[model samples]
Structures are given as structure tokens and as C-alpha cells.
Target: MATFQKGILGGFSGKVGNVVGARWRGKNVMRSLPQRGSYTATAKQEEQRLKFKTVIGFLSPLVDILNRYFGSPQGDKSRANLATSYHLKNAVVNLPTGTVMDYAKVLISKGDLRGIDGGTVAAAAAQTLNFGWQDNSGQGKATATDELMVVVYAPELNLFYTNVAVATRDATTASVTLPNFMASLEVEVWASFSKPETNFAAISTYMGAVTVL
Candidate 1:
């Protein structure tokens, strides 16, 4: 049985005979029920599935942040969707071992805002990560008040340490202290800048990988 919110003329949600109706991306959608059978995916289909899954899983940790600053929604696609599409195409790779992310190519945010100049990161004592950049505020679309955003991922633990709005672009330097458990482990880093009051952001830069001290 299907449920309609506004009589027979309105869109429905639920199962009706062989068809399934549901809301998708805010639109009413319908599709036929899958037939009961063992199905094998083609080589291309399998590849696509692996790529999609890899991107989605790799991005799960940053979903909320990305949705907030990655980019503006285009049509029905949200900011998260745009970021996922970008990573799938440019960051995931097919190597002999398997499909995996090229962490150095990842972007935590994407937009028209101008990025910091000479951005750099280094691991420091007490599991702290230090960041520095040449202040390019007032250049192009950049602003002195643009806030810094950083993401640190420790692959061995499959965990992330995110610091948003930790400092403004004009500060030229900032720091992030991770849990003690992260000490001595290798981690990947990325950084970006966003307005303190809006969802707009600069395209993030990979700050290179480092072993925590």
C-alpha cells in the first residue's frame, strides 16, 4: 500500500504492487521492484561500485564539514554530493592492490574564495600540528577575517582530527592538538579558508603527510 500526502494527485511513498515509490533528492520517484535472482555485475559496473563506495566511505568523516563549506548546491545536488563527485574523479585511484584514495589530492573545501599563500604544516611535540601560511588577505577575493580550516586523518586508526575556524587568515599561523593516541603515527593533512559568517570557502590544499611527534 502506498501513502499519499495530498490525495491521489499528490506524490506517494511506499510500495504498490510491482512498483516502489519514494522521495528522492526531494522529488517523487518511482521504480520497479528488483526481481528475485542472483545477479552478477559487469566489470565496468563493479569498478564503478568500488569507486563510488571508496569515495563515499573516505568522505563520511568529513560529511558535515564538507556539506557546510565545500561548495554551494547546484540544482538538486548538495555540497556533499559535489565534493563526492570531485573526489571520485580526481582523488581515488585504481592500483594493483585495490582502489584507494590519493590523500594528497583530496580537498576539504572548494569555492571561489582565494586561498592562503605558501601554506605549510608540520608535526610538533605533544601530538600538536602546526600550520603556517603567507597572509594573502585583501588579495583578490580573500579577506583578512577568513577563517582557517584544517583536517588531519590518521589512517592507521581510521580517525580524523578536524579544526575549523581555528584562526583567521591574517594570523598566518595556527595549531591543532590531537589526542595523545595519535603520537608517532603517520597522518595526512589538508587546509582551507572560509568566511566566518558564510558557507563559502577556498579550495583546500593538501599540506602533505607527517608522522606525529
Candidate 2:
């Protein structure tokens, strides 16, 4: 039986050789198999090819959308409220007697008077009259006899007020009458130097104002 099986296998090998010799060299042997419609790639290779194509297609549309949404955009940040600074300048003390009494200048910077609550006299004390008063004799003196009266004018409010006096006696006098000079918002200061019969010459001078931004 072993010999018979060996003989049969040898005959099969010979038959395969004969079929191959009937065809031309290098011709596809697979073409003789029954046709199963069409050839298709394995599942893994097909999935990999699909992923590669998807990646390539995504790039152009992604760039176009980003450019349309974010490129060369306009901004309205210029309309914001701006920081500003102001200082007192050349304040002239116009006495009721028609005489321009004295002139003084004020220096104002942001940090000089920090944490001052708005709309109060003490809040604005950092900007005060620089000394040297003009007396009734028209002499510039370093000191005044009574108090210094200042007339404040606020340009933004278009108003003027009178008798915002700085007392010479008390360095810390912090109260004053709110002036009713103008309907517009403004600030003015004045000092009183004498009582009736006091021969202390009335002085007037300019108190300066300034602003910084």
C-alpha cells in the first residue's frame, strides 16, 4: 500500500507539470482558477487607505474656514474712555475791590494725591496754593496775615466759586463752605487775611491748576 500511494503522488506531480508546460512561460497560473467576480483588498489595507484619503481632504477646507473667520478682523477698542490728568494753573485772586491781588501756581500728579475720595475739599488738598502772597501794598510775601481765599474755576463744569479759604493759623483746617458760584461744576479757593480794622494789607495771587494723562 505504501508503494501504491507514492506512485499515485508522483503521477499527480507529473500531471501538474504537463498543465504548466501547455501554457506560456510567466503566464499567471491563477487565471485558470474559476473567476469569483473581482479581486478586493484585505479589510486592514482598505481601512488604512480610507483614513489616508480623509486626512488629505481635511487640510484645505480647514485652512479656508480659519482664514475667513479670523483673518484681518476689525476692532473697536479705540472708543474706550481715556485716562486724563489736570493741574491748577496761574490762579488769580480777583478781589471784590476790583484789584487783582495775587497769582500762584499748583502742581498736580496722579500719585501725589492717591486714595482721595472725589467731591471733597481734603481730597483735593495735595493741589494747593504755592505760598508767597501779594499784599495790599502789592508786595509778594512768603506768609499771609489771615487766611488765603481762592476762587476755583472748573473748566469741565463751566462754573466758578468763591472763598475756598486756607487758614494760615491752622495747618490742618479741613472744612469750607461749598461755593455756589456757577451752575456748572467747578472748584475755587480763597483765603481771608484780616478782620475789620486790621491793617494787614489784603493780598491776592494766582493759584495754578494742571492735568495729566
Structural similarity to truth (TM-score) of each candidate: 0.87, 0.24
Error of 1 at 105 (Å): 1.6
- Report each candidate's C-alpha RMSD, comma-separated, in the order given: 3.2, 36.6
Model 1: number of clashes? 0
- The TM-score leader among the candidates is 1
Evaluate all candidate structures by whole-model CA lDDT and list the values in order. Answer: 0.89, 0.31
What TM-score does prediction 2 earn? 0.24
- Candidate 1, residues 24-77, lDDT tens digits: the string is 766677788989999999988988899999899889999999999988999989
Tens digits of lDDT, candidate 2, 90-164: 322233453231223321111111111111232223334233332332223324233444345554554444442
Worst 10-residue stretch by lDDT in candidate 2?
A: 79-88
Task: Give residue 4's error in model 2 in angstroms.
Answer: 99
lDDT of the structure predicted as candidate 1: 0.89
